[model samples]
Target: MAGGLLRWPVVLCLLNTLIISPVRSTVWTAGSAAMTQGTAVVVGAAAVSSTDEHFVCATLDWWPPEKCDYGTCAWGLASLLNLNLSSHILLNAIKAFSPLKIRLGGSLQDKVIYETEYPQEPCRPFVKNSSEMFGFTEGCLPLSRWDQLNEFFRESGATIIFGLNALNGRVPLSDGSLGGPWDYTNAASLIRYTVNKGYRISGWELGNELSGSGVGARINADQYAEDLMNLDRVVDQTYKGYQFKPLVIGPGGFFDANWFNEFIVKAKSSLDVISHHIYNLGPGVDQNLVEKILNPSYLDGEASTFSNLRDILKSTGASTSAWVGEAGGAYNSGRHLVTNAFVFSFWYLDQLGMSSLYDTKTYCRQSLIGGNYGLLNTTTFKPNPDYYSALLWHRLMGPKVLSTKFNGTKMIRAYAHCARDSKGITLLLLNLDRNSTAQVVVDPGTAQLSAVKYHRGGVKEIKMGEEITREEYHLTAMDGNLHSQTVLLNGKILDLDAQGGIPVLESVKVDALQPINVAALSIVFAHMPSFYAPACV
Candidate 1:
């Protein structure tokens, strides 16, 4: 049986009451709750690694409303053609970060035809065809629709990484391998059109998970390299008169060391970013999904992927950096009440922390607004728990990642980074143990609870002196339900406002010297304004 804090959590659920104050719009005082004191370490001296400025990214897949998985169709009108681009919430969600990276491509991307003027073809939407690959006929992207998308992107202040079809004009071999040169004809025309229209494309990624042991169709490493070089040429030529050319990202697939090492060595300098996908949590419908998420050993299993990729990048001296192109913990569109609920934040936030620790440049979650794993609700365009998590990460955590260690319990996962826009560092603490509360101490050198207080004690607002205070944003599910869509930040409910805008993510101030109190099954973002780190400075 999973244990919980004292009567406070139950009281909140029973009364259906929330504690909110008016001093700060988003701030709330922490009432008494059960918190077991413990010792955890935050190496505040310097940073162990760093990530890209826009480290937090999300994908916008090409799957239409007809896209389904395991007999369930979760994707509504969230496709590019039908998403409410003018939605105030959608605009506010992306604009909240001022600049969120949105990847525009997916499995259907390889089969998509971009409508161009010169070789104008019939521009149509995706039609359900079970016989065709990816369960859809070749879709067409109308130039007019492209204009609308770009307009929405511009208004939302988003960084765009458009994926191109690499298997174009290639015939499928007997073994399901795409063979032949990438006919960059249509792609080049689209690139040319984008350049002429002055679209600010952050990158032009080739293919979708079609590298080693590809997902639908595999491409030879050497052939893929040649195609990448051709892509580089096309990009350079298309943006000849432009001030800057979009980055050429390629071979976005699961990490296969041998294939990656060879591709990196062969495609040297041609590729700007080496990308990979992560579906470590298994399929969406797995019965043990929750159990796997709560298991520390299972969560740490993905470290090898990051570490190995880092090794490949270093050993080969590859000029390109690593990026998790697309990762939705549960693949096949993800599971409902699991991937879309508050519990998933455990996996999502942990991935952000873990990936950054490995020096990953960018980590893009699977769907920005599609499928069951979407950060935003498919119908109302409201922010999900993961959306708030991502937003908080973007607003608080900086690019510089610090070395954080927790020697106490495996149930407590910790990651620290320099504050995004402040002095000091932001520490993300995820408590997977539902039975015991975790009280974290930033530095081992700081005053810690005695051994006697390990299993019993109430959360405190201890006097750390110097009026030094830290900002803490605690995220928990409503009614203590992990499957709840509504989230409470600092004990205040988070939701879209009357104006359909994301609610303010406020924080409560606690004594800087006090040990951070992390509730069970909850996540905490503690910003220590007093702790000075060389990396942060």
Candidate 2:
């Protein structure tokens, strides 16, 4: 037995012995219960809709300016720090999933003041404050800095959705309405400068969390709608003869039923996309982070907001679609290891699958870098577990979302999509069960199953004929440490190559007829090359 173990790779051997040991006996029946009563999931070929590229978007915040001094700041930190947009590693990571959308705004966005004169000192530090939203007083983005940012966006192949300040020296009236017209002078100047410099921004979003009663300050729906129209006029006038007009998106804030309904109804066709933010699990300090992420009911609860927004748009006769402009599992930074670790993939991927079902055109993550929930680490810029998950979703899952039905417990969630630029379907299987392993049988409608099954004890023989090809990329942590940022694909850790290039994704090929053993607390992305899903083509 010891000699036989040496035949396989060290990683595979370790995985078999340490991680997924004690193989359980269970038959996963695909189609009708007559074949076997085991757990099963059927993936349908019918396409729901063309997948939205903006579905996988991220953010570049404008807070805690990267190069701060003591009590003052310049060149908002995210522009100078967090994103090394020019780095080979960063660029390569981004290019791996090209055509990425990045939202450049945050709480400090409303506080930012763009200066045409180049600052003598680019960045200064401000007094450290306990409140996450209070340190923007020192924030300034000079023209030179903006130039650098635009160039970086161009090189990174990113579409910029910039947020303009809404509360710049504005006040509320006696009845708590916007006292005067929004002070768009500072914002307009910056937009005009960006256009003059030939920056290709894709969309212009106004305000940050100023939609519903507001965050720090409130803006009535009527006033906010007027502000949106004013911004629309600014866009039309500024780029009158430009070849491509940027999309006008607005009132970036949380969703309140009445507030959203009124804004959409009043804004009418002025807004291009309805944008909103979500932090479903509350704060990062919550000790029940793991429990919350693993619960299907808890995850599905966010769907109501999406459905409501869609209904609102339809009822209001607005042409815009919904976009989750910003969403992190938790607010105020994030739990150190929980948000960045392999376990976070459960929440992140499920959100992607759920959002796509509700016709959400785009879903931008809270951040690409900075904060504990970033896809990449803030200091080292190393790809977190969620980073690899995002890459795989981009590479394998196509724009066409397909329907899936699983007969097992809700602990094992399933989502299907047409394989990107391929002739088959990709199934994303997430096993959130922390204790017991689950088995799944993929049903390719009406086709006869034929394949060989290899197990630890011996090979389980099955009818064989035409090749039934299947490939899987399983993500899990080493040493059973759910908090560890390190991720293993298949049975190997994904690390940088000797030359610092991104590691290639390792996929394990299997027969479609065999039952797939989904280990506890793991994610499995399966690609079936045989079943030709018409939507993919």
Candidate 3:
């Protein structure tokens, strides 16, 4: 829990009617919820951790590609990617943004970076820098991009695990012959520049989706293993001059249990982290599809897959973490625009909550912008439905995932976190049902609660374009278009409605009463009053 004085209005009349044998317990604000929640709350009270309790959380995995407009990449470079109306926009959104990892993809790498001309390809209007017609020909080696990348990592607290080009034209030859005339020297130079510029990159992946489809030069499992080994040696030698030997990232493709096992056995030492991708697209939003993506059983399946890989790595004396590098809702254009609808929040939230369980080091989404899979709309640079979900997780979901329960009907999904900063304990509750408001009784066991602030809205409608509130204040709406803002903090009525285009909600200073009823299909961000409050399981 973060330490900050939170002031809230005392709903005197309201509480008087609702009071029922509630003990006047004084809550003690304490430390990180990540550790404290599991240690003092669930383990101490519920006796959960003592048994088969597990901790699973999500992390970013994929590096979103930059969209180019006549050679200039747009997206978020102009300004903040909040999709709000602003006078000045940025040119390179990727510069300030820190992606979880920069994946040098295996299959898509050829299409995106090289721009090679493929025969028998679907006919479409020809466009330069388009991966559709030409692959590997579009120069991806821009020093400016790399420089911006270094700055991004430095600014946005993230590490880069760069992927080496391993597509049709980028793979290195085992023999001492440069058969493809590919200039790996350029790659070496960029790496050296990253080190010289003080970029914090420690891992390098070879390729992605190499085995599936017509990707990767079609190397067999054993041959691919040997190829990865040679590439590892070459990469080390190339960067040795600069005293930087990054851990090799490899076998980034779809989940192939047998192939991964064999490859791990053959090329264990050559890799540092095994990479894979998972997309849950099972024909529309039917029960089967939702079950495949959200059911605990599916997670169990994924866990089994990763566990087998880990065992194989252990058997081969190769111990490294796993990452879900490129993924999104259903993969192909994200099941159409419906993926951008606010309803997808539940899915995103579930993914984050479940990442730690899978032991995933990082879980990257496919595209930050562009494609239906993007969290932000590529045309207007506005946040899609998933963006708000991602932001909530990023802002509220602390390092530690605290144990919690729904109490009543399981319609509401809640995940609490002890904050690293001294901002009191934060509770993120997501009500997934679109049609019914969820009445919840929040029992932060033993911890005396003081104040709470909530951010809530309808779960379906996603507002687009710039918004100006009643007060003419300029602001942006992410996913849930907030409405009828009303806030009272510490007995002081805050004028927090529409003001200068900025939409306002309840005051952050107000204390909330217990037995709160959260609206349906809504995401409520509640912050307790106290820097380090007592443990609330």
Best-performing candidate as measured by lDDT: 1
Best by TM-score: 1
Runs off by more than 4 Å, candidate 1: 1-35, 444-465
Q: Write the per-residue lDDT of candidate 3 for residues 189-246, one digit (tens) a residue.
A: 5555565666767676766666433233444566567767766776677567666578
lDDT of each: 0.83, 0.73, 0.44
Q: How does model 2 fare in lDDT?
A: 0.73
The better-scoring model by TM-score among 1 and 3 is: 1
Score every model by TM-score: 0.90, 0.84, 0.60
lDDT (10s digit) by residue, model 2, range 430-521: 88877756667665443222332222211222222333457778787866678999998876788877655779997876655456656778
Model 3 regions lying over 4 Å from their true place = 1-107, 111-159, 168-202, 211-218, 238-245, 282-318, 402-410, 423-427, 441-516, 525-537
Q: Candidate 1 lDDT, tens digit per residue, 64-143?
A: 88888999999898887788787888999999988999988888899989999865467888999999988999889889
Error of 2 at 183 (Å): 1.6
Instruction: Report clashes for each candidate as comma-separated counts.
Output: 0, 14, 63
Residue 274: error of model 1 in Å? 0.5
Write out the backbone clash pairs for model 1.
none
Better of 1 and 3 by lDDT: 1
Candidate 3 vs. true structure, TM-score = 0.60
